[model samples]
Target: MHLVHLTASTLFGGPERQMLGLAEHLPGEYRSSFLTFRENGRCQAFLDEVRQRGFAGEKLRADFPKVRSVLRELTDRLAAMRADVLLTHSYKPNILGRVAARRLGIPVVAVSRGWTWENWKVRQYERLDRLNLRYLDRVVAVSEGQAQKVLAAGVPADRVSVIHNGSRVADFQTPDPGFDTKLHSFFPADTSVSHVVLSAGRLSPEKGFDVLIEAAVHVLRRCPTTGFVHFGEGVERERLEAIIRERGLTGRFVLKGFTTDLDRFLPWSDLVVLPSHTEGLPNVALEASAAGVAVVATAVGGTPEVIADGETGRLVPPGQPEQLADGIAALLADDRTRMAMGRAGRLRMQSRFTFAAQAAAYQKLFASLGSPTVFLQERVTCQQPPSPPSPEDRNAPTRPGRFGSPTSSTT
Candidate 1:
């Protein structure tokens, strides 16, 4: 089976990473190609990581001219590839892919990462996503919450399938060898043993990072040894920096910007915090879990899907810095508790959220639509091979999945 995938932005956001994950981890038997919009996508790093795993990749420099141009380019590519299926991420590609597939006689799968942002255009975006989903052979929501949003937008309940985004277990290097240089270098050096807190992702208001900055004041006053660091850059940089300075936290909070090497940083921190007001499934949390780090996150979106609240990590009400601060403090105060939570989180990830499992799920979804090679009931399994080990797997979970792949499948 041949599949062509399309997306508008290539930033390493939730949906973009999932698209990369599917392309990278799909069983070698089925052919897949990924096309990203624009010359340099933030998502390019993810695709590069895919190729590092030994798969051929293609990138397209496409952009929006008008609504019609999207459909035209989509149909053009679909025909050129003679694609049996066109899988699309985000709203623009979803709509274009659905319409183009209909015109080109191919199946379409529309995958929803989550709401782009809560804004005036949300209704318009939601409406278009609904229309696009209606035309899909299948609609996949990255989390159950995402599925609810799909139904709330007027798509039928039966039309949406909730498939949690998968992470490349091999990409995680738990002992983040460059923990100091690549990531933690931005933080104030702790001459004495200190409390360290780190958060990764874009610098947007929706990330609730400003909330983390607000919470930092109390954390700093209470614990002078505490060092706060953030990795990621975006529109809210100046604003977040200003808030940190005004709060008298100029020396305490460090904004490191985006880095390709997060594995190094996750292992160095006392804790990882995700203050996102909204999310589908977060790759950072999974990465942190794989690195044996505890997360203090807002109990929004698919976060609950990965975190077991008090068991694996702590979840607090969104937008509440006090709650976020308290949770972080509680975890940091007890070394045994923090390590236990991190280990539990790691266990959960290795068992259920590996790239191989997620790829297996996607293979099934594509095959179910009769686009990718279909599996008979007698086949009784999937065709994706096991995920290759990343630099970090030296201390990772040992058990591999049992999904059988064709012997001819490439490693």
Candidate 2:
């Protein structure tokens, strides 16, 4: 099936990364491509890495505010490629993809990734989202919590589907002995870690970074040797920096901004934390788990799905500084517990969070949406999936083998 994936935020946040993962492994002949608003993006590294694995794709620039022109261009391009489905990430693409897909008579799926309504940008996004839902054939949320939030925000619950983002099991591997040391060199010695705590994401208010800073202060009062480093950049960098200075946390905390090579950073730390107020089955937590870094995160959005509290990682309430601090400190003070949790996390991720699994989920959704081709061989298949049973044609059991055969054994 021919498909178009669209998103305005050029930066590859968690959702875009998940999209890249799916795109890379999606089946041949399905004909999936990307539609990026900005020419350059944060996920370029991920996209490039995926391409290295061998997936052909197209990139388009939608930089202007002229919706009419952009819509015309997008519609023309989709028509040219003959895309059967238009899939979008974030609000901007959702706004445009849904509208254009309707005009083009193509199915569109809008994904709600994280906390949908908390930030100031919500109003502007809401303005663009009007009646866009009507055009969307389906609205997929990466987590149940994310789906509920979207429903609360006025989208119909019946129209939404929850599909958790999956991690590439192959991404997990043993670390070289000096790997962390080499990565630590990127930051000042003080920030490197006698006992290191790490968090990654765009530094923003919705991330509740201020709470992380506060938590760090409490963690510091008890363990002076402990230090925290946050990886990523956002609108709140200057504000977070000022808070760091005002709180006299200069030497204790490091703001590393954004980095293209996440593997380099994961090994240098003992624990990973995400104090985000909201999220969609967070990729950072999954990556941290896969890297064998014990996690300490706020219990919000899809975090609970990944973090098994005391088993895989610790979870604290969002915006509660004391609880946040306690969680971080608990893991930092006990290496035995931390390593135990980290190992558990690694195993959990490896077992269930594979890239192939994630790709399968999207493939199923796209199939149900009736996208033209189907190259993604389902985990359960004999040959081809019995023509997908005429959209929930349940009475007809699937016959799958080679991926496109109608009578092949359903694997």
CA error at residue 68 for candidate 1, angstroms: 3.7
- How good is model 2 by TM-score? 0.83
Lowest-scoring 10 consecutive residues by lDDT in candidate 1?
402-411
Model 1 Cα lDDT, one tens digit per residue, 314-385: 999999999888988788778899999988888787787766767776776665665333312212352232
TM-score of 1: 0.83
- Which stretches of model 1 miss by more than 4 angstroms? 12-14, 39-56, 118-127, 173-176, 181-184, 189-193, 371-411
Q: What TM-scores do the predictions have? A: 0.83, 0.83
Model 2 misses residue 92 by how many Å?
1.1
Compute the lDDT for candidate 2.
Answer: 0.71
Residue-level lDDT of model 2, residues 1-411, one tens digit each, is: 776788765455666667777777778867767766754564465456546655544555554577888788788878887777888876678887765666656777887676445457765676566345534657776666565555545454445666667765565565665766755554466453578888888776788889999888899888888878888987888989999999989877888878766765786688998998888778898889888888999989878888889999899889999999899888889999999999899888877677776677677777665433331222124332122112232232322121111110110
